[model samples]
Target: MKVVSCLHAAVMVSDLDRSIEFYTGTLGLAQVDRDLNYPGAWYQIGDFQIHLIENANYQASDGIDLTVSTRNPHIALGIQDLEQAQQRLLAANCVVKMSNSGRAALFTQDPDGNAIELTLVDPERESTKKFDII
Candidate 1:
């Protein structure tokens, strides 16, 4: 019916190996095993995950300090109903983009082009922390 919790945050990284080391070493987040046929790594932090998608061409957002602005890099929120969420976003004239991966999720922007994802996921049963292979 409403946003239940933050599922994860998708961040674009330049180097997979380097970023992975930083996240698992410096940040001390357990790396979760993920094979999405894409260049990315997932890490576990309590009930939430940090998804890092490797992009050699990745560049930080303009002057706006995205860390506080919450733009470009996005957070995915767990929702009860996909259709209901989509309807609400659409009603507010928000642009919605369905997940191309066929998952029960949709993407939208927060007026500032910062991507927000609404996904149907149960965080309680979804933590990959226990399944950490690396």
Candidate 2:
């Protein structure tokens, strides 16, 4: 029922290769190999992953406005209990969205509309889970 740790932060980019180069060459983040089925790249930032997805339909922000909050990006967190977290968010009048793939995930937003993804960790496979494949 609690957020264990931040798993990843995903950002939409106009060009996947350029973003990956910047993150890997400039930021010095290790580029983590991922499945080719998806058009994206992953980098290892400490113990967490930074996912960069190419968005062809993304519109550039007019300007950086500190007052606007809904435009903020999302952060995904690892959760201890998916069901409990869902219940807690629902009790607080938060809109929870389930993953279409039936994965243990709950998507919600903060009061300001900033996205948050809560993912359930499989206890048995947590330590040995492989991300390169999927």
Candidate 3:
């Protein structure tokens, strides 16, 4: 399967409201309507989503070294097929973590320990127009 586009990038934060204000007020990202099913907020970045998750267990500025480098911040990419991507990653001996949200997602790491998330694209949400980067 091929990566269709970048879906979202998740960043952990201590305060969700503060981060939301910074992203929306400071950065001028439009806040989209989302279900508060979890401790996070979704912002519209052109056609992509920026997910700000409030993780009380972990702080973004924490200097503690982690075993898995990919456990830090990560970027999620949209893919054509989730199962095919999982199989490809497994075949390459890449460590893949399944999403607990039951969404079609696979989290893995690069050689440098950078986290990467592969997610299945929802056809209904796909945009046809190209995003103009300023």
Steric collisions counted per model? 0, 0, 0
The residue ranges of model 1 lying beyond 4 angstroms of the native Cα positions read 62-134
- Worst 10-residue stretch by lDDT in candidate 2? 63-72
Residue pairs with clashing backbones, model 1: none
Report the lDDT tens digits of candidate 3 across residue range 54-83.
Answer: 776654344322344335576656666778
Q: Candidate 1 lDDT, tens digit per residue, 18-65?
A: 767655653346898997998998987667888888888876455433
Could you tell me every candidate's TM-score relative to the true structure? 0.48, 0.46, 0.46
After the best TM-score superposition of candidate 3, give how far the Cα of residue 68 lies from its true spot, in angstroms.
22
| Candidate 3 Cα errors over 4 Å, as ranges | 61-134
What is candidate 2's lDDT per residue for 1-134, written digit by digit as tens?
99878788777776677666545653345888888786888878547897777776654444423233223355665566788878877766766787555667767654333355667765555565433211
Clashes in model 3: which pairs? Answer: none
Better of 1 and 2 by TM-score: 1
Candidate 2, pairs of clashing residues: none
